[model samples]
Target: MALTADSPLTELLQENPKAAEILMRFGMGCVGCALASGETIRQAAEGHGIPLPELLEALGIEE
Candidate 1:
């Protein structure tokens, strides 16, 4: 399944290992944290002050 802002971070990481690198590049090095399991991509990005659109682009998700 394609990733989206609402996708759980853990699910995204499990589905695409490359997503770890993308998250790290965006200064979100908490992939292994417990919260990742329940956190959505949008929540993480918003918490880190990351622009959702930029992150989506980096993840190769179409806007």
Candidate 2:
């Protein structure tokens, strides 16, 4: 499934482990944290001060 800004971090990781690598590349190495289960892509990006569009693009997710 295509990932979106609202996709839960845990779901993304489960769906595609590469997503964790992508997040880490973006300096968001929180994929293993408990919050990853509850946090959305948008929320994670915001919390990490990452630009949402950039994160989406890196993840190959359409805005």
Candidate 3:
């Protein structure tokens, strides 16, 4: 599935643990952190100054 700003990090990780690499690569190791448990991928990426499109690309998500 193509992830969006609405997709929670936890849910995505649950569906694919390998996705953790995507998060970590984007400097979002906080998917397991309390403050980011419910945060969306877009939100975390934005917070870390990472572009969402780049993140998706790192995760192998095609446009």
RMSD to native for every prediction? 1.1, 1.1, 1.9
Clashing pairs in 1: none
User: CA lDDT, every prediction?
Assistant: 0.88, 0.88, 0.77
Per-residue alpha-carbon lDDT of candidate 1 for residues 1-63, written as tens digits (9 for 90 to 100): 777888888888888899899999999988889887889999999999999999988987654
Candidate 3: where are CA atoms >4 Å away?
A: none
| Cα displacement (Å) at residue 40, model 1 | 0.4
Q: Write the per-residue lDDT of candidate 3 for residues 1-63, one digit (tens) a residue.
A: 766666888777877799987788777767689868878877788889998788877766543
Candidate 3, residue 19: the lDDT equals: 91
TM-score of every prediction relative to native: 0.90, 0.90, 0.80
Any residue pairs clashing in model 3, and if so which? none
Residue 20 local lDDT, model 3: 89
* Local lDDT at 13 for model 2: 85
* Candidate 2 residue lDDT tens string, 1-63: 777899889888888888888999999876898877899999999999999999998888887
* Runs with alpha carbons beyond 4 Å of true place in candidate 2: none
Error of 3 at 27 (Å): 1.3
